[model samples]
Each structure stands twice: as structure tokens, then as C-alpha cells.
Target: MLRDFSAQALFMGLLTAFVGFASSFAVVLHGLTGVGASEAQAASGVMALSISMGLCAIVLSAWTRLPVSIAWSTPGAALLASSGAVEGGFAAAVGGFLICAALIVVAGLWKPLGRMVAAIPATLANAMLAGVLIGLCFAPVKAVAFNPAFGLAILGAWAVVGAFNRLLAVPAALVAFALVLTFGIDIPDGAFSAIARDLLPRPEIVAPVFNLPGLVSIALPLFVVTMASQNIPGIAVLKVNQYEPNPGPLFAATGIFSFLSAPFGGHAVNLAAITAAMCAGEDAHADPRRRYWAAINAGVFYVVFGLLAGAVTAIVNLAPPILIQAVAGLALISAFAGSAMNAFKEAETREAAALTFLTTASGVSFGGISGAFWGLLAGGLVMGVGRFVAARKAKKV
Candidate 1:
């Protein structure tokens, strides 16, 4: 393993950590607060998620001898943001997180469970995700309307750097956001003192409150989004890089970590898709066999970064909420585009996918179940009818 260490691997690993953390922590912060977490609680959630994913990556890569990268469920966080405040508040949301983690664990241990999730229509899944992200994706524009100077600054940073390196675009925007916070926003008295106090996070164990609304709104949709968007795509990325590690254990490992972190305010952690490529690809190492070291190094960096999550939360809290949301929206644009493209990729499924996207984007809820779940269900029903009608026509012919 020592012999496998290389400068290229180390550098790529560091870059992966920086990009992954910088790119989306605002989303996590906004998601947590949207669901009723205090700044302290949200910071704890961020810290827990960061450390959990890092540990998951390190352990999985070591055990499987493959470049395995783990990440928090960014899509799931978006779902939470869309779902808004639940009945029992953040505690209930934590309960939902527990259920989602349990499902992921079952999906790994039980082949039937995994297959059932995999059987979901890709178009509907992508549509549902795109719908979930629509509100956040619009934040940048709204941010500009709210405050052009700050908002355009953030967008300009992303657009300029994005032209050269797509990977660094969000990070550049994050840097721009820090500048906005520093030079633009007026500081309140004692805000700096509070930030210094929160520089080190203290994880809080939340008591789970299970209810039907939380179960349907938070748990079910979160499980589907995390698995379909993050975990499965992560596996595909590894396979594309010619790694042959079994997917079951890797999924289970992430679920276990998510479960551990959920009690401490973290929503979910799972396999990485975007960052996995950096660790698994040739950029990490010429020898595919040696690329696991890159993931390991990334895992190390993640843990170090996790220690600073509280400070991040503290600093971000001082900014206007919409400005932070603008940063989140910028971070999610790429994900939104990819998902929207896939949602309507097939002509046969286009109508159903459109229905899913529209239903989810409406953000309507019934009996506490979120629009994401309803969107998928409605799309499935319509899709089923379309197939059935075609089948009957064929018989008549």
C-alpha cells in the first residue's frame, strides 16, 4: 500500500476533497435549516455528514482494494429543502433519516430490495430529482433580484471559472460568497464572537420521532433519491474505470455510516458519483490498481475538513439566507441539467417524465406525503396505462 502511494494520487485526492466539500456544504446547511435545525444543529449535521462519508470511503476502499469514494446525499438534502418543515420538526426529520438508512441497509443485504429500487423507471427518478431541485436552482436568479451586486458576483465567479474547469466552478462561487459575506454584508455586534465559539462543532444526538407524515415525506423519497442518484451512479463510475468490486457491501457500508450519523443530525451519506471519478480515474494514478490510494487520501482530507464544518456554518449563518441559497443554487445547476436531460431522454417515457417533473415541481403535498413521491407514483400510473394501451392495440392488430 505504501508503494502504491504517488504524488498524482495524493494531489487528486486532495482536489477531490476540496471540490466535494466546497461545492455543496451550503446546500447541506440550507437543507438542515429548512427542516428546522438551529445553526448549531445544522453545523453538527454538516460535521457528522462530512466525517461519516470520509470514514466510509476510507474503510470501503481499504477493504475492497478499490477506489471507493463516499459522499453525503446532496439530492436528498435538496429533497429536504423541498419538503420544508415537517410536523414534529427536525426530530421527526431525523427519524425519517433513520428509516432511509435502514432501507439502504436492506437494499444492500437483500438482493430483492436492491432490485426493486433498481427497477424504478430511470426517467421518473430523474424527473423527480429535477423537480426537487427546481426551487433551489432558481435561487441564483432570485438572489440577483434581491441584491444584484452580491448575486451577480457569485454567478460571475461560477461562470468565469466554469469556462475553464467545470469541477472548480462551484468552489469559485463559494469563494465569491465568502467575499460577499466579508466585504459586502454588514456584521452584527458579537457575531464574530459567536462564530469563534462555534468554530468547533459539538455533535448533538437527536431523539427520533416516527410518524406517518415523516415516514412518507422524508424517508421514502430520500431513500429513492440517494440510491438512484448517488450510490448507483457511483458504482457505474467505478465499473467504467474497470474496477470490479461487488456493489452490495459498499452500499451497506455507506448505509451503516448514514445510520450512525443520523442520530447526530446528519441526513444521509452514500457513495460518491462525481468525486469517485476523480479518485478512480487515470488522473488519480496510471495504474488502476493503485488508485485506491487516492480515495484513501481523499478520505483523510475529508476528515480534516469535517473538523472545520462548524466554522463554515457559523460564517454562513451571518449572511442573508437568500445569498447562501444563491450559492446552493449555483452548486446544483450541473446536477439539475443532468437530471432534466435524463428525465426526457426517451420519447416513449417523455409524457410520463414530464408529469413527474411538473408534479414534483408543484411542491404540493397530500396527507403529509411530499410531491416527489406523488410525482413518481403519478408518473408510474400514467406510464403503466400507456404501456397497457399499447399492449391492447397490439393484440387488436
Candidate 2:
């Protein structure tokens, strides 16, 4: 089989989807908590996000013959969670989301800004991106520490799958859940009730109302974080997969979709790196020309999921903890190591990167976003000052 349809390609695409599904749940949960949302509201939001990402991925993959996946802004959720109090709650988070979406749409329509983003040095962009993902992976590790058995089970499953079979490795999290269920892990009593509630018939509307204060506090930080963290890396994924994607249209579409769907529960949307990698690879389809089918399949799944938001959330709630933690930890390993690698690569810049890493790891917060934003700022400043000093010394000599 793989010889016929490109097993490697399929594996990559599936791996990407697995990561998106597993790691994103944390961010989604955070967003839901920030807003003090009802289970239904939270499900609706996730559903919108799933649909937006899935649809965007389908369009891009189909048109470009590349593996492309879309996802919600992870960094945006962090920003919302931190500054949620200031903005007065979930309503403000929604406002901030709308503003972020508008900015993306505007940027997409503006050629110069898009080109400038594209012109940034890949190394620096990647480094910045790595800084963003470091903490995301760490979050799951922290969760696991409090639940040793769950964590160990997840770890064991990951190790076994990774060592024994490459294909199994991507879906190991899903498998771990089955094991947990088999062993009769203690789950929340109302888990079944939640699941049943989600399955009930209902229309797809959330009655999103605008709040100026929330937009002001939430918008700028959310936009910057999304661009710096998710979109930049998403673009990088496309390049690595040999897809020279047009970032402008992609960003624009994501913005439009997010803006239109925000009331219905969608936030900022952007390209998906991990999932895109899989679709771009050869294994996703037998004919290179036909890989669009996978993307189309993803879109269909996303729309269905979005429409059934409640049920999906309930299902996620029921999923084994080990499955979530292990999958997130394993999938994010590459991102974590990559950030650390670049942070210390150059002797002259090492100090700056080190400062950035430490500050970010310290979990400092300022102006809504955390040290991930400040770490980049601090590193850039250090590098700038060092360069300026070096130039002056050379002139003096």
C-alpha cells in the first residue's frame, strides 16, 4: 500500500490532524473557561473553529494540490485567558476575536504588509514561532504531574507506538483512550449527561454581542499573538512541504470566515502546520492530483462537527486524560526542541535568545500577552544593542 498512495504522505497528514485535535483542546478549554461559557456555548465555539479550519484547509489543499490544514489561534486563547478579567469576561474575548479577525482581513487585502511579513528571515521567524509553542507543550506536562497514572499511561503508549509502528504513533492518543475505558478509569459522573445534551437537535446560532472595552483590551494582543505564533509557523509548514502557498489570500479568507462566524462561536483562524504537513506528503493519496480529496474530507468532517458542537465537546470531555496529555507532549516535541535549539545557536545572539527563553519560561505577563511576546521583544532588543555596539567598535578601529 504505501507504495501505491504514499504512506509517508498519509502518515504526515494524519499526524498533523492528530496534533490539531489533541493539543487544541487545551486552548479551547481555556477560552471556554475565560468566558464562563455554558457547555453548549463552548461547544458552539469549538464547532465554529473546527468548521473554519477544516473548510480553509480544503480550499487551500484543493486549489494548490498541497496538504493544508487550518486551526484556531492558540496564542490568542492565552492572551484572552490572561487579560480576561480586564476585559470583563467572555464577551470581551469575543470582541477581541472580532478585531483580530478584521486586522487579518485588512492585512490580507494590503499587499505591502503581506510582502513584508513574507520577507522576514525564516530563521528569525521560526525562532519566534518556536518560542510560542514551548509553553503550550509544557502545559500538558504540568497537568500530567498532578495525575501520575494518567501521565505514565500516556507516556507508555507513546513510547510503544513510536518504537513499534510509525503509523500507530500518530493515533496513539486515540488508542490510549480505549485502554483507559477498558480499565474503568474514574470519570466525571455527568459525562454521559453532557454527551447526551450535545446530541439534542438545535439551530446553529450563539447571539454574539459586541463590547467596546473587551475589543480594546483583547484585540491587539490577540492579533499580534496569532500572527506571531500560529500564522508564521503555518506558512513555514507549507514551504517545508514544497508548497509555495499564497499567504495573502489564505490569511484573508481565514479572517473573513472568523469575522463572519464569531457570533456563531469562531475566533481567529489560520493555517495549520502539523495537519498541513500530512496532507502535503505523498501518503495521503495515490495520485498527487487527487490529494484534494483528503482536504475535502476534512472540510466535511469539520462542518459536521461544528454543527454538532455540543456532542463533540462532550466527547472530548469523556476522552481519557492520558490520551490528551501524551498526544500533546509527543506531538509538540519537535516544536519544543526546535525553539531551544535556535535560542542558543549563535554565540553573539545566544545571550539574547537565552533571556527570551528564560523570560518566556518564567511565565511573566504584561499588557495581556505573556512573556512569549516579551521574550521576542527582549531578544530582539539585545540583538539590536549588540549589533549597534559591534558596528561602533568597528568604526572606531
Candidate 3:
């Protein structure tokens, strides 16, 4: 079963695996900044999530002979940076992690909640995903305005790779990344000395505190956003890749990871769809049995990356901000388009789906949870009622 392991496959897999870790570091750090975390705390949390995901991915993938890669939850990080930045600060952000972990643990333990989540319709889920990611997509366009040259370079690279995908195959993102780096396009600029000085080999943990304001206003909303925005799409990615594992165990693992790391500022952990797709593809390993090694390879890199957290931070800082924004936006384009298309595909329920999309895009917040979750819920309820009414009328006839 472990017969075929080409060097090329290993290289592609490893490259793809490093993507989210490297790409999202800036955003994570920015989020930390928003929450008033010192640069050191922000970097440490990033290191923790990277190392934890790497370890978990290695064990799970090798044990199951499946290509299971994990990354810091992008949506979770986004929510933390935005809302968790307000009111309660970093400690409040920790509260968010604790709340999300507890809820996930309960869901993992009780099958009913999982089932209810599963019962949500596919189109609606896609719509929710689109809404959740709309901000991410438009972010790059805005970045171009900030730094036209760098943003355009990244976009141009994407266009070149996409046009040649048939010939270039899986190396497109890698090539694009290389070209941007080589072209003297600066995305961010953190000096090597500054990064080395800021490195934290040991992390300081902040114990969970229960403030009604923190939990209800901050933590609860963050939890809702993580579950609704991050977890759902993560699971969908798994299903899309035909590696749909037991949801209970998966959620359990995430909860356990989150619970353990919350005090140290670890925000959220979940199965990664974009990065995971790299491992699931035929290119990662022709023989499915050995594909797990690709994830193991990624995990190994993650551990190594964790040890060099300071250097990694420095490197991210050197890259231009526009590059980060453009790449992130470009990477997520397919996901956004897919979600939007599904959101409005049906005639009868299209209006409800539109409501969800618009509300989510508006970025409104009642408490801590982003509008994406509430938007989907409200739209889904309306659609469900419409279906129920139509079915009842048909039965009477």
C-alpha cells in the first residue's frame, strides 16, 4: 500500500502544507495586535497552533492512512482579531476560546447537536460559507488600492499560473509565491533582529476567567462565529475531498486542542479545507496508502516552523502587506464564488439565501458572533418554513 512515493509529490505536498501556516501568520499577528496582545504573545499563539496542528495531523494521518492536515482556523482568527480586539482584550479573547472549546466538547459528546448541524441544507451551507468569506475575498482588492504594484504582481502571478494550470498542474501556487518573492515586491517588513529578539521559547498561559460581559458579549459571539463560520466550511472541505471522518471524533479533537491551548491564547483549531486539499489530491501521493506521509511531512514542517517562530514572524513581516492580502483573497476566490452560486441557485428559496448573503457581507454584530452565523440561521429558518407550508398544502390536495 505504501509503494509509490515520488520526490515531486513530496515536494508539492510539503509546499502546499506550509501555505496556510506561512500565509496567515500576518493576519494572526494582526489579530493579536487588535486584541492588544504584545507582539510576543501573538507570535507565541501562532507558534502553538502551528505546532499543535502539526502534531495532531501527523498522528491522525499516519494512524488512519489518510491525508489529514490541520491549520489555525482562518475564520476563527479573523473573528478574534476584529471583535475580540474590542472590550475585553487578549484575556477576553481567551474567554472566547474557552467558550468555543466547551461548546465543541459538548457537541462532540452529544450526537444530537452534530445531527442538527448536519441537517442544514447544502446550498444554505454554501451560502453561509460565501457570506463568511466575503470579507476575505474583497480584502485583496482593497490591498491593491493600498499597494498597487505588489497586489497587481500577486494577481498577475495568479493569472499566469491559472492560465497554465493544465501544463503546470499542482505547482501553481508555489510558483506564484516564488515569483512574488523574487520580484522585489515587499508585502511586510519585520527586521530579522527584531524578530529574533521577540522570540518566545516558553509560552505564558492566561487562565480562563468567567466575566458575564466577556462570555456573553465577547466569548459567546466568538464561539458562534468559530462554529458557524469556520467549523462548518472545514467539515464541508473534508466531504468535498471524500475524507469525511466521524464528526464526533473530529470535533472532539478540536475541542481538546482548543481547551488545552486557550490559556496560552490559542484561538481555534479545525480541519483545514484549502490546505487539506493539497494532501487529498492525487498529486500528493499516487498511492492513497502513502498519502498520509505527505501530511506527516507537513506536520514535521509545522514543528520545525514552531521552533523557528521568531524567524517565521520575521519572514512574514518582510513580505509586503498587499501581498498577504492579495494572496489570501486570491486563494479564497473559488470558495467565495462557489458559496455565492449555491446561495442563489434555487427559485423559491433564493430570496432567503440572498438575505443571508447580504447580512453576512454587511459584517453586522449583535454581540460577538459575526453576522454570517445569524444570517444563515435566519435565512434557513425562513426557507424551512416555506418548504413546510408547501408540503402541507400538497398533502391536503
Candidate 4:
């Protein structure tokens, strides 16, 4: 392992962690707050998720000898942001999070259940994800309308960097955002003082309420989105990179960590898709076997970043809301494009996929369930009917 260590690998690992965290940390914060968490609680959630995913990445990579990078559930965060609030407030949301984590653990331990999750149609899943992302993707353009100077600077930086290296684009945009925050706008009074006071993140134990409505709405949708959007794509990334570790144990590890972190504000942790590709690919190390060290290095950095969550939250709070959303939207543009492509890639699945995308994007909610869940159900129904009709026509022929 020591022989495999190189400056290039180290830099790649650090860059992966930076890009992953900087790109989506705001989404996590927004999700937590949207679920009714206080500022401190949201900060705690960020710290917990960062630390949990980091430790999981480190342990899994060292043990499996694969670049098994872990990440906080970004789509799950998007689900939370779109779902609004539950009946019992943050405590209920916390309970739902616990349920979601437990379900993941179950999916890991039970092969049949895992297969069922795996059997979810990729088109429908991707369509649902596209729906979730479509709203946020427009934020950059909206921000340009709201505050041209701040928004355009970030967008321009992303566009320029993306032209050279797509992986670095979001992080570059984040840097531009920070520069604009520093020089373009006046710092909010007492923001620095708040940062000093909350320099260390403190875990706030939210007692779980277990409301039925919250469980059905938040817990179920969170589990489905996490598995479909994050884990499945993550495993595919590993396979494409010529690494196939036992996903069962990996799922269990992430689920266990997520379960442990739930009471302290973390939502969910799972196998990473985007950042995992960074660590597992040739960019991290020439030798695939040596790439595990890059993941280990990234894990170390994630923990360090988590420890500074309080300071990070303080700085984020000082930024304009539109600018934050705009940066986040820019970060997700690649993902949105990928998902949209996958959703409509097949001729047979096009109509179903379109329905899923439209329903999910419509933000329709019923019986306390989220639009994502409803959209998937609607799309799946259409797909099933289409298949049935095709089979009947074939029999007649």
C-alpha cells in the first residue's frame, strides 16, 4: 500500500473529496433545513454525514482493496427539499430517516429484497431523478436574472473550466462563488462571530417521533431514491471501472453508518457514483489495484472537512440564497444531462419515461407520499401495460 502511494494519487483523492463536498454540501444543508431542522441541527447533519461517509469509504476501500467511495445521498436530499415538511416536524423527519436506514440494512442482508430493489427499471428511475433535478437545474439561469454579477461569475467560471475538464468545473464555480462573496458583496454583520462560536459541530439528538405520515412520505421515498439514484449508479460506475466488490457488505456498511448517524441529523450514506468514478478511474492511479489508496485518502479528507462543518455552515449562511441555489444547479448540470439521456434512450421506454419525468417534475403529492414515489409508480404502471400489450400482439402474430 505504501509503495502505491504517489503525489498524483494523493492529489486526485483530495480533489475528489473537495469536488464532491463542495458541489453538494449546500443541497444537504438546504434539505435538512427544509425538513424543519434549525440552523444548528442542519449543521450537525452536515458534519455527521460527512464523517460517516468518510469513515465508511476508508474502511471499505482498505478491506475490499477496491475504490469503494461512499457519498451522502444527494438525490435523497433533493427529495427532502421537494417534499416540504412532515406533520411532526424535524423529529418526525428524523424518525423517517431512521426507517430509511433500517430498510437499507434490510436490503443488504436479504438477497431477495436487494434483487427487488435492483429490478427497478432503469428508465423509470432515471426519469424520476431527472424530474427531481429539473427544478434545481434552472436555478443558475434564475440567479442570473436575480443577481447577474454574482451568478454570471459563477456560471462563467463553471463553463470555462468545464471546457477543459468537466470534473473540475463545479469546484471552479465554487471558488468563483467564494471570490465573489469576498470581494463583490459585503459580509453579513456577525457572520464571522457566529462562525467562531460554532467552530466545532455539536450533535443534537433529535428524538424520533415515528409518525405514520412521515414514515410513508419521507422514509419510503428516501429509501427508493437513495437505492435507485445513488447505489445502483454507483455499482455501475465500479463495474465500468473493472472493479466488482461484493455490494452486499458495502450496502450493509453504508446502511449501518447511516443508521448510527440518523439521530444526529445525517440523512443517508451510500456508494458514490460521480466521486467514485474519480477515484476508481485511471485519473487516480495508473494501476487499478493501487486506486484503493486514493479512496482511502479521500476518506481522510472527508473526515477533516466534516470537522469544519460549523465554519462552513456559517460561511454558507452569509451567501445570498439565490446564489447558493445557482451554484448547486450548476454543479448538477452534468448529472441532469446524464439522467435525461438515460431516461429517454430507449424507444420502447420513451413514453413511460416521459410520464415519469413529467409527474415527478410536476411536484404532485398525495396521501403524504412524495411526487418522486408517485411518479415512479405511474411510470411503472405505464411500462407494465406497454409490455403486456406488446406480448399480446406478439401472441396474435
lDDT for each candidate structure: 0.93, 0.62, 0.66, 0.88
> Can you tell me which runs of candidate 2 are displaced by over 4 Å?
1-19, 31-38, 61-67, 74-86, 115-136, 139-144, 164-170, 178-183, 187-194, 200-225, 228-244, 315-330, 367-369
For 134-160, candidate 1 gives per-residue lDDT tens digits of 999999999999999999999999999
Q: In every candidate, how many clashes are there?
A: 0, 13, 12, 0
lDDT for 340 (candidate 2): 62
Better model by lDDT, 1 or 3?
Answer: 1
Give the deviation of candidate 1 from the true structure as CA RMSD. Answer: 0.9
Higher-scoring candidate on TM-score, 1 or 2: 1
Sorted by TM-score (best first), the order is 1, 4, 3, 2
lDDT digits (tens) for residues 61-155 of candidate 3: 76667777777777666544444354556776677678877877777778887666557676666666666667767766886787776666666
Q: Report residue 248 deviation for candidate 2 (angstroms).
A: 1.5
Lowest-sum lDDT 10-residue window in model 4:
363-372
Which residue segments of model 3 deviate by more than 4 Å? 1-9, 30-36, 81-86, 165-190, 199-204, 211-245, 314-323, 367-369
Candidate No. with top TM-score: 1
Name the candidate that leads on lDDT. Answer: 1
Clash tally for model 2 = 13
> In model 1, what are the clashing residue pairs, if there are any?
none
Sorted by lDDT (best first), the order is 1, 4, 3, 2
The number of residue pairs in model 3 that clash at the backbone is 12
